[model samples]
Structures are given as C-alpha cells and as structure tokens.
Target: MSRSLKFALLITLRGFSWYIRHVTKSFLGRGQVPVIDSDAHVVETERTWEFIDGNDIRFKPVLASARSEPNNYRWLVDDKLRRRAMLSDIDHLRPVDRNTQTPEDAREMSDIQSRLNHMDQLGIDVQVLHNTLFIEQVADRIEVDVAVCKAWNRWLADIWSKGNGRFRWSCVLPLTSINDALDQMRFAKDNGAVAVCMRPIESTRTLPDIYFYPIYEEAERLNMAIAVHIANGNSAVCDVLRSPYDPGASFGMFRAMTAVSCHSYMVSELPQKFPLLRWGFIEASAQWGPWVAHEARRRYEASGKVFPDNPFAEFRVYVTCQNDDDLDYIVGYVGEDNLLIGTDYGHFDPSSEIDAISILKSRTDLSTSLINKIVDFNPRNFYAI
Candidate 1:
C-alpha cells in the first residue's frame, strides 16, 4: 500500500478504537469511569456554630431560648402539611444535623470517608461540597447572617483542605451586605476556596441589591465561579400556599424550573456589566435549559434596541442537572460543553450513588471525552478547581 493509503487506514482504525472503548465503557461496563459529583452538601458541626455571634443580643440568647421556645426555622412554616413536606421530604434528602456528630467525625464522614466510599461505589473521583441549611434554610434571620457565614467558610476550608485533593469546597458568602460579601470572598479565596455559594433569591433594599456589580467584579478578579443553589427556603412556603393540594410536588417541580430562567436573566445582565465573571446554577435540573436558552435568545433578539450587548456573553453559566434528566435533549440544545452532572447524592437515598454513574452512561450521544467533561472537567473549569 502507498504511504497516503496507510495514513488514511491508520486514521480510520484510530476512530474505530475510540468508538469501541467509549461504547464498551458506557454500555458493556468494561472500562473504569472517573465520576465527578458537581453538587453535594456536608452537614455542619459545632465548628459551624463558630459563625454564630456569641456577643450579638439576638444570637447570644438563642441556645437558652431554644430550650424554652425552640426557635428553629422549621417552626416558621405554619402549615402542617407544608412543614412536614419541607422537613420530611426535602430535609430528609439533605439532612443537616448540627448535633450528633463532632467536628472531627463530620470531617471524616463527609470530606474523607463518605467521599471515598461514594467514589468506590459510584466511580466518582471528586466531590464538590457546599454549605448545608445554614445559608439556605435560615435565610430569614437578620442578625446571625454574617457570623454564620464566616463560621461556615472557616469549617468548609478546614474540611476541604483535609481532603488533600479528592474534595473541593464552594465558599459561602453573606449577601446581606455587599462589602462584607466582598471581604469574605477575598478571605475565602486566600484560604483555598474554589467558588462562592449563593442562594437564588431576590435581594431587598435593606440588603445589598443582587445587581451590586462590585461582587461580580471581585469574583471575576479572583477567577471564581458563583454557585447559585435554590433550596426550600421561605419561598417554598409561598409556593405551598399557591398550590395547596400537592404543595411539595408543585413547589419541587417549579422551583428548579423557575430558578433557571431567573439565573439566565442574571447571567444575561451581569456578564455585560463585568464581562469576566462566570456563574453556575447548581442543583437545578437540566430539563429547563433548552427552553430557557431559547427564551434568553428570543427576548434579547426582540428587544434589540434596549439591550445592545449579547445577553449571555459574560455568563458562562453551567447548569448542574440531576443525573436522570433527558440528557439527549439537554445536550442537544445546551450542547455538551455547558452541562455538568451533579448528583445531590449521599443523603437519604442510596440509589443516588448507583444512579449517578448510570445516568451518564445512558446518554448515547455522549462520547468518553464528553462524559469526562460532564463528570469532572466542566466543574473544575467552571469553579477554577
């Protein structure tokens, strides 16, 4: 055979080999896959209590007041069914026990042992840990906000650093004040935090506006991605009243769907304002991506005169979808590059451990390279981890 014919044959053979390996691993389960869980939560400990203000009048009496009145946030949701749904269904899946476990034990279980066991079972190589209910569950508190955030970040840094490299942490910031948030971001970055974690809620006038450009500018300066996660906060209660019959079901379905569009709007505007800051919406399902992306494009195109800049330019938004979503439709519209596979795993359901890997392999269109990106590389790239 001539040299050119030999080269062509070699290229064809290489492509064939790539396809075979990819298929065998995905379908036949013949190859080892490195999984990366982009989203997971670690329960806080007494160390997390370090964030609480020992001196503040509101928090100083909380422990004693709890003994008398039990001022837990769970009590604020008055409706019994809604409260049960929030505590039983939602909290069950993502348990936050500030008692029971010591700081050392919490570290060993969540950061070290649980991750290792999960990786062994699910084939995950890394897990990114975010704050538990401290940020999301207790958002209504006005006094302990800054203190709780500081303590959370401190504990998070310690836990993440203890993991060596297997575990990564997204820093928690108090959006109650923009200057405080900026200071915390700098402190977090200096102390080895990869990303900042924020709840996806609108800001009030008393609090810093979400449009505070300085936070985005500082995040961009630090080369960090902001992880926006929506939880069953006070918003869940409002959702419950809106749909009384099956409140939990209605709220659960709509929160993730609504969060995508809300974040897309933020992504559209923030990027144009700062041009360098990247954002990722974590724990939100992938099903809404195509529609949200289409709407984003549509709205921008319709109001061309008012919005001259590309709405999605500064927004390198990565949607960390549930493992079981319609991967084909998601990958098709959003493209493989933008999707990250996040398993809100290791909570109550053991099935999450197994299903995480199965979900990735089930996607026929995903090549081994693309799978790798979704599993680990995408998160690392987005969060600078």
Candidate 2:
C-alpha cells in the first residue's frame, strides 16, 4: 500500500469516527432533553474589534501587554486601561484552559466549528455566549461605548450565522446613549441575540432606575430577555469590593450586585412595568432567590403593599442555579419554571461549572422533571433558545 493512500485512509477513519460519535450523542438519546448552557462565555480576542465601522475605527479597542510580563494584558479603550480585558487576564482564578478539551481557537470562537465540536463533547446543544470585555465598563466615553458595542454586536452576529443555530448570545448596549443602544438591540434581535446584557449596577444607575426603562421597553418590543449577568459597571463599587488577597472576595462584588439587582427589581415592580419582557438573573446562583424574595416581601409589607406568593413567576423572572445550590429550597421561592442552569464556560470563578448539566442531573434531591426544567425547559423558555 502506498504511503499517500495510508494517510488518506487515516483521515477517512478519523472523520468517520467523529461522525459516529456526533450522531450517537445527538440522536441516540432522542427521548432525553437537550441541554442549553444558559451562560457560557466567549473569551474576547483581538479579532473581536475587527467589525468596528470605518468611521468608528478611531474608537477601536487596542489590546496591550507588558513587555516584562507577557501575560499581563489589558485593553486600551478611550485612553484608559481595562484590566479585565479577557477571561485569561484573571490568571489568579485560572480563568480557562485554552488547550485542554477545548482548543484555544474554539474557546475564543475564532473557529466556530471547533467550538461546536467542543459543545458536542460537553452535551451542550446550544451555548448562549456572553461577553468577557463588557462584564465591566469598556469605555467611559459614550462615543467609545456606542462604537465598541456596535462592533461587538456585529461580530457576534457573524459568529451566530456560522454556528448553525447552536450559538445564541446576550447583546450589550451603550446604556449611556439610549438611542444608539436601542438601534443596537434591534440589530442584535434581527440577528441571533436572545437577550440583552445588563449589570446589576450600571455606572451610576441601578437596574430599577428609570434610566434603564427605555432599554427594557426596547428589549420587550424585540421579545428579548433582560439578562442581568454578574457584572459591575460601577467602577467605584468595584474598587470598594475588590480584595487584593482573595479572588473570591473581589468576585463577590459581582455576585452580590446581581442578587441586589434581583431584589431591587422585585421591590420596584420593574418586571410588572415591563409585563411582556422576561428577566434573567444569571451566573449568580439561585440560592439567593429566597433571601431576595423574603426581603422584597418585607419591603412590600413596609410599603403597605401585598407581595405575591411567587414573585418570580408573577414577574416573568428566571435565575440560574449552581449544582451546589439548595434547589429544593430555592424552588419554593423561585418556582420550578423560573429556574435555569448554566456553565460559565470560559471563566474560572466560583460560579464556573464546566460540567454543571451532568452534576445537576446527578442530584438525588431533585426530581427528573425539575432537573429537566433547570437544564432544558427553563432556559429555553427564559432565553427563547
């Protein structure tokens, strides 16, 4: 046999093996519910800003690294350095393993097919990609914000087009400029974004502030969920909460803010105001659901109002749960239908659970139906995935 023939045969066998594995995993479990990773992340790469418009080229974000420390990277945006430029920047947490089961190109999503293959391995039928850069404020200037957000949305849209419906995203907007934000939301909705990303505390405004009402109104009109991912747009708050020695203490700022957002929204009746819109409190585990619900109930009573038996259901709100969370208790406040789960794919924080779907399934405390809702039905209903 010729050496060239042997090489071709080897390639053929590898391709055939991949096909068999993919088909067996996808179709063999026809009766089983498909898993949707509600909060997977896409680590930002230099390629992310390539979609910036010609006129906005001046506002393009520049990736910079120190000469002495090769891995000390940050994004230079509007003459400022954003330390958390990429998931890998937080090396203390060991954010992501680029060359592990997932390839670097796949994790950053420069190669969409490779990412899909990794998803297949993880049993994630669809991954709702979130932005790593936009977790914190990318730019203080409105022009920069608008330009950068437009570019990011366009980049995600292109990825979605090539993903074969396996990648949905949460779109970020220039909240400072409501008009530009609305336009971006429309573009995102027309493309493949299932939700709009918001922080619990966005700059000087909180989620319940009327400043965000316009964004909420537009999101509802687009039939998109307001996904309040664990983020701190307020730099002052971040500074106060950040601990030099403890990464968990620093990261707790984001989790606490998201929980506060949920509580604030419930008390403010923001969800009721936007009746048609769905609200998602993600990454921050659902254990806080009962606490927030209880606090909201007390605030309602104090204000001479009657709190509903299930605020989450009444408000069209959903929250993500971790495998370690007490779902049996959280369910009593959040209700089964309003609970979802996620794998914080690219980041290695406390919430990061690459095998969350399988782990949740193994919980003997939860019934099969409830587990299915957390992994499948709830996420599909929340993000319309």
Candidate 3:
C-alpha cells in the first residue's frame, strides 16, 4: 500500500497493543508510582502512557522555497557549492504524504495520533513540536524572509493551539536583520512560543556576531531560551562526507555527527560574549557534551590568560541529551544543571516520552532529585515556563 496507509495501519496496531499493556499493568498493579518529596509527591500512572500519548503532539513547519533547487541533492559535492551559490535556489522540502492531504495539513494530526499511541505504550507525559527542515529553507533568503518566518509561525500557533497548555512550540525567526529578528521574537512570545529555534551553521554570520546581539537580548527579555539546531546536509561539513574519495559512504549517517562538532565550536565561543543568553543545542546528540566541555576548558586554560576578552569564562551552556549513557558523562562534566532531555520524537522514532523518562529513571547513579530536574525542572528553568 501507500506510505500514508502503511502509517495508518501501524498507528492502529500500536494503539491496540498500547491498550493491552495499559490494562494489563493496571490489573496486575504493576504501574509506576510517584515519588514523594518534601515539596511534593510525583505521581506516575499505569495509564501514564495513554495520558502522554494523548496529550503530546509534534508540529513541523514547511518552507515552500527550499525544495525547488535543481542541484539540491548535488549541493553535497564541494565543486557544486560554487554552482549552488550562483543559482541561489530555494524551495520547501515537502514531507512524504501517505494520503491525499498535503503534508503540512496532515503532519500534526498524523504525528499526534502515532505519538500518542507510542506514548501510551511508553508512559510519557508530553512532547513539544518543532519544524523538520525549514531552517535550511530560510538560510539564504534576506529579502522577504520575515514574511516567510511569519507564515510558518502563524501556522504552528493556529494548528497546535487546541492542545490546551500541553502543546508547546519552537518559533522561527528572520535572522537576516537584527531588528526584524527582535520583532519576530516579540511576535513569537505573544503567540505562545516556548523556545526560539535557529540553525547553528552561521549562514549569515557567527552566533556571536554583534549584529545579532539584539536578537539574543530580545530572547532573554522574553524569557525564551534559544535553540540552535541543524537540518541534515545543510552545511559544508556534509560535503566532505559526499566526496568522490568516499562515494560508498552514506550522507545521512554523518550529517548530524558533523554538524554536532561544528555546533560545539560555535557554542564554546557564543556564551562568553553573551553571558546572559541561555542556549540549547537541539538534535546535536548528547554524546558530544563531555568532549565539548573538555575541549572548551582545554582551549581556555591554554589561551584564556592571554586573551582576557574570551567568551568561554566559566561558561555554563545547556544541552538536551537524548536518552543514552553518554548523558552520564555529560552530566559529570557539565553538572546536573546543564542537562535536559529530548527524544526528538514524533518522527520515524517510535520511542515516546515515557521511554525517555524510563531511560532517565534507569540511571540509578542519578538521584530522584536529579531525574526530576532533568525531566521537568531544567526545561522549565531554561524556558522560564
């Protein structure tokens, strides 16, 4: 059958399995319970999976211009980079539809239905939505960029606002101009954005470029944390992987890995100059945290004395760790305060919010207090929720 029908069938099967597990756990009294503390008792449910799946939804924005480029796929080649610059192509990367509905129209409902079913199976609370590949779409446009940003932001608020207070959002900004970006930040805050998202590629300039200070200031003013993320194959690093010298290698496998290294370098430098700015690197994976911290510290110790104006002074940058053991090392280096959890769920990954929570709880070396901080507290503290 078609992709849409396949997804629908999968959702139905997953939902049925989830109901069985939910009833079985409640009947056997094998449900997870809340931990009590001096301040409050945290209650978990056997039906927690159902609640999480039912409540949490994913929102992905599409940029209409990113998919139109002739050399879009070939842009991965180094020689083609010059050709891409000359073409100045822009188009939206359309999502694959399994049915007659447009991807944008169907993505939220489909993702919510699938995610809710998975959440019921996994016992998660909720998931905040983010865009798929809009970052790459807006990277090159300077003129009329604000309009494109507004279009995506308005669509997200309109479609996902019915989720009561459970649905959260990451807003898109027009970074071509600092003034325009500041206005967009205000617009996003008024429209219920939980965080502001941008690419880490420095397409216009480095994150610390003085031109963007007003944008950072606006984010801090609105109490929304800045999230720097990367769409696959949007940077020069991806070109290195697609080189003829390594034709057998897959481009998709190395995109995030390469972007994470580039992002670490950018993060190490941005915070020192904008010390008040709270930032998180999303979709960059949790494993790189310790190395980033170690490298930043090493470089600072070696040259910090010589360059007193450096931005890496006692820096405390926050990062979202995917459920993994590398988080154990990241927390050891950055401390519990700097780590948060994100499953990058609601996509191909069937793991739900509960699965992420279980992973967090499974860290026996970590205290209940620490787990609570990672699961709920850190995000609230960072986003000022």
**Cα lDDT for residue 113, candidate 1:** 66
| Residue 190 lDDT, candidate 1, scale 0-100 | 81
Candidate 2 lDDT over 1-385, as tens digits, reads 7542353344346434533443336654577667788989888777988999999999998877778866777888999878556533454546463212346678788888888888888888878899888778788899999999999999999999998767889999999899999999999999989999998889998988888888988887676889999999988878877878875764567888899888888888676687677889989888999999999999999999988999898787899988888877888888998898888887776778788887788878789999877776677777765
Cα error, candidate 1, residue 303 (Å): 1.1
The candidate that achieves the highest lDDT relative to the unseen native structure: 2
Residue-level lDDT of model 3, residues 111-172, one tens digit each, is 44543444445454444567643434333445445554565566556535653343457777
Least accurate 10 contiguous residues by lDDT in model 1? 77-86
What TM-score, over all chains together, does every model reach? 0.70, 0.88, 0.62
Greater lDDT among 1 and 2 belongs to 2
- Candidate 1 at residue 309, lDDT? 32
TM-score of 1: 0.70
Query: For residues 1-385, could you state the per-residue lDDT of candidate 1 as single tens digits?
Result: 7542353344346434533543224534655544567776665433445545456424421222234534332322112211211121233343242211122333334346655654556566667777555333444454455665676677677666666456667887666566788888988888767677765543322112455567767877787777776543345544554565763553453355346545454435555565555567766666777677666666766877353232222255677766557777777666666678655553332113335655576667668887876875566566655
lDDT, candidate 1, at 124:
62
Best by TM-score: 2
Choose 1 or 3, whichever is better by lDDT: 1
